[model samples]
Target: MTTPASSPSPSSSASATPPPGIPDPAAPPAVAGDRITQDRPVPLLRVCHFELVKVVSQWRTRLLLLACWIAPGLFVAAVSQQSTLPTDTLFGRWMLATGWAGPLVVLGFAGIWALPLLTSVVAGDVFAAEDRLGTWRHLLVAVRSPRRIFAAKALASLVVILLLVVGLAGSSTVGGLVAVGHRPLIGLDGHLLAPGDAAGRVLLAWLCVLAPTLALAATGLLGSVALGRSPMGLLLPALVALAMQLAQMLPLPVGVRLALPGYAFISWNGLFTGPAQVGPLLIGVVVGLVWATAATALAYALFLRRDFTNPTDGVPGRRAVTVGVLPLAALLAVMVVTVRTATGATGSGIDQEKVQRSVATAFAHLYRVQTGQLNRPDVTEAQLKATAACDKGGSTADPEGSGNDWRCVVSWHLPGVEAAGTALYQLDVTTDGRFVADGDGPKEVNGYFLVRTPTGDAPNPLWQFDGNVELLPATPKG
Candidate 1:
């Protein structure tokens, strides 16, 4: 030939080697049955599967799952060996009374710390780790579509969190049952739930918490995308959780507190009550959905627009903070205002009638349990006909607000007794529609801190009781 064959052009050279997930159009055709060699786009599910495999292959993920499975066992054993129970927890005081309490107590503790930390560890690192490793470009080259990649990673992170929750719940429940022995659990409404019923409730309670847990995970995902650093991503959700906890303790309006994502963590408390309240559950679901939706959408937007041209892009620390904080703050403020407007002031949540009704219902249930404990004839709640009148604080203080100072006088008709019995209770009411009533007893009926049962001395269900009133707008009577 007159001239040597022209060297392959740079564009042609690049075209010869297509990215991993993308197929080569110039390749020879494969056999009809060989679909693997065909030129086609990768499916979203396949991408998600690859991401999940990548996550599960990591050592930290394996360690996390193992810890989730083992930690609850250790907690149950430790509490069993101790002289003191974790009375501050929702079911902690009943540790010795029923084995089921172990799972519930562990659940309470997990909501406050364990779940958020565990969720963040995976979600927070998922995307940022690639950035840290200078592999984001490589990932982009493989997948070609950032939206598909984001969806896969987000779905994979959710699967990981879901696995963790299942492991923790199963471990705590099975371990508690095996170690502590199955016994009736004292319901939050001052009644006893059989072992089988408590088990169902406990599992359901764990399932209920998944909403907030996932919302927290989505938040971590947002942090991962914005910060582009694993550590910052890991800490963001945890910091947010800490802030929410502090805010919950403050004198915030009922609706405002209900709208916060953290409220979902403790919303399962209503499930343990005799007449299970679903209002808090509904609020928790709504709040969780709002948070998850906002965080995930923001993260998706950030991921799509991220500059993959520079692998070593300097961390946009200040910009990330602005991008992350402002939107979230605006969303929260809007939610708070809307909820407050819809539900009125905090005072509307805890009124005299609601408190009185709640107290009476709790007392009636506990009195039935007391009679059963003393081997007295059985009495139905209808026969008891309980009634209560509660006064919050002295005349000098504002009558409408929630405070530690409240007195309730409860009266109920007791079976096989000529006259109705009366009991006084000192109540500490909170802004979030919860109260603790310490019975000022007639000793014989209310019993002391410990009541005599057929088996042995047990914590009196009537001595000190916790109650909640739904803070939603009152439904019209039929």
Candidate 2:
């Protein structure tokens, strides 16, 4: 009995003096309902995998992936079949005619709507579908916490977006290059767009197209987590975008267009053109980051607090879609009506004979002074003066306009050359009354038919002189 008192068996000793403050090994294991275990969910690859599986399980995401392929192909085909003129500048040179080739190839084919919307469909759905499908409860048990689940979902979503973007860029670029003739690209402003430099810029421009759309996608995520319908998030961001575009297009004060997502993303023009404007470009990028980050953060928080078990369960609402679409439809309708009103002028078609006569007269006078063909007319004194007088009263595309709706300021002074023929003409002569450059080299003649000097290579001293500056209208009008 004394011996037994000296040494209680191991089990008796353990039970009598509870294990020093540590959790007793003998206690029942924790489950979801248990307080300590309930509070903490251990991070695990299994959790990440579980969320990823859920994302891929949805069929809509797969359909979007399919769209990613089909859209660019259709665009390239349309560009090839429909286009008709070279844009003239190196960047846009062939864009007017060819959809795939040259610098404008990206713009002409991918265009304004397709790529942006394709990105939106996939990006907009990432987290939104989770709420749409009523699957947050299933997600909760697999992942330790909602935040971690949201993070995995977002990362997976981004990977999907990036994959789609890559598909779009590669397919479009190839399709455009193949379908439209790939000549050197010219810009809308007619700048020489080098091909090697331009290819990279265009690829980047396609990438930058992602800029404004990310916020749309991020906002979608927020709506998914908060509203249980991803579409709610889709509405406000698109509305913000729509409102900004309207404000920008308005004949407003400075900084107006800067607010719009579409306007901010307009810097892709610079990438295609010779001189890219980085101010708008950088602003858009920064703003895009802010928009995406804020929405994502909000989604994270909402998702964290959401009662996914019951869902904000109700019939999914479509007000946001109506809100998104109606304004845009109205805008398009207004634009169509306005365009018809402005263009449906009560007038006969343009008169070519009168225009030809005027252009011929101007050419004769200017060429005589520059070439000393008429021993320098007393009125056509200096370079500027001769160009001015010759360009004045030029015939226009309009049948009724007294002066040419568009004018020309033709000159050629190669950076190093000190010659009369080496001039680059700035022809501010479009039907729209906008400026358009004509020749980038030398002018063989003035405005009408005449041949002078050529550079680089030529047959003879006469026809070789072919750096003439002529502003062709939308249609070569009167």
Candidate 3:
């Protein structure tokens, strides 16, 4: 050391103790710039793929899918063995006679609760499972972004719902075709549809329900995120659906009823009629998409803001409460105001021109249907030459109010009768727009009863009286 510690060689000097803040020169010499390169966020498709794999691997999911695939066949078999057709539901009267009607029966049952329940099983559990398994931390760390994770989970749930719907529709179609032959189908308009056309319409009707089903899945996902991973998350959405359905059955205002989810579920009925109306179907699609978008946004925002490090933070806080309560309160206030307005305006009066036109159209259709049932090809709308004039309590001042004392004078000519006869109709109009009429006409027409002779003995033809009729609003003729 004294011998000039021989100014250390260049190599030895470079390897000597380094400055305190500087990195070691020989330790693979630190890179010139930032030592850690930031990795790009995981792709959404990859995340969704992972979620799909997770879902398909679970025994619960597999079991539910299996049930969905088999239940329709079992239902068709059981229904085929029954002696009576279920006539309460729309299109149910023909369920046992035609393959196309079978799907309608299944759809009617599914709309009650089965579809929602099936959708919720996976949607409610997708997000909650992470928290239940104490793996949120791991998932967050692995995915590195909560938004992407939520998107992946939601997409997976939607995919699962689609699969379920397809399975149900296909299975029902196959089972129905096997159990009941693909004969001509009777439409809502009382017209006959060929077998091929009937199959197409049935398939379209089944596809129309996809919108509402996706909305339900979104609702379940929101519940899972807000309520945490639990059974409540699974049950609350179904309860909400049930409550909505009940609300639809109430005497609510038209606006409010149209806004409910239950209305969307049955919108597919429009597809089965001639001159198909797409308005309700489009509205349903809009409502479903809005609900799904709003729920997805809320879930994503809440998940991003949530702090999983603190257990107490997992519960919905003031912001969540405010987010939920404000909209509900607003909706409730609107509903209350609408219902009150509708109830108080019962005496607002009706439009004479509208009622007159409606009555005329209704009478024509009623006459045609009645005569057709008796196999009377000679009795036609043109031959009857019907004309109706309606009055409310014999005054034109207020023609459109709820009353039991409305009257219509209808004039028509019977075949081979030279003179036109006038019939007096006593009408009772309800607030819900139904018409109950009792007619007093010539003794020959008033006392006559039409007997329909059935082509087959199994289902006896129904009989009709000539002078009484119940009619719905003119807007929906069927």
TM-score of each: 0.85, 0.57, 0.70
TM-score of 1: 0.85
**How many residue pairs clash (N, CA or C atoms closer than 3 angstroms) in each of the candidate models, in the order given?**
0, 24, 2
Candidate 3 local lDDT, 377-417, one digit each (tens): 65665777877787887754467654667777767778998
Off by over 4 Å in 3: 1-37, 328-455, 458-478
lDDT of 1 by residue, 339-412 (tens): 67755634346677878888898888888877877888988989999999888776666555478898988998
The candidates, ranked best first by lDDT, are: 1, 3, 2
* Tens-digit lDDT string for candidate 2 (1-478): 3554466789887676644434345666566554555235747566667656655666866776676666665665565565343344223324433433432344433334444554455545666666666666656654547677777777766667677667667766766667764544533333335566657667677777676667666755655554456465445445555565555444432232333445435555544333354444555565566657666766675556555555444224453334334443454354334323433422211233323333333333334333443233333323322222124344533333223242333332223446633233333332211223333334344232233333322111111111111111223222
List the lowest-lDDT window of 10 residues for candidate 3. 461-470
Q: Who is ahead in lDDT, 1 or 2?
A: 1
How do these models rank on TM-score, best leading? 1, 3, 2
Score candidate 2 by TM-score against the native.
0.57
On lDDT, the leading prediction is: 1
Each candidate's lDDT (Cα)? Answer: 0.80, 0.47, 0.65
Runs of candidate 2 exceeding 4 Å displacement? 1-53, 81-93, 96-111, 180-183, 234-240, 309-478
User: Where does candidate 2 have its weakest 10-residue lDDT segment?
Assistant: 459-468
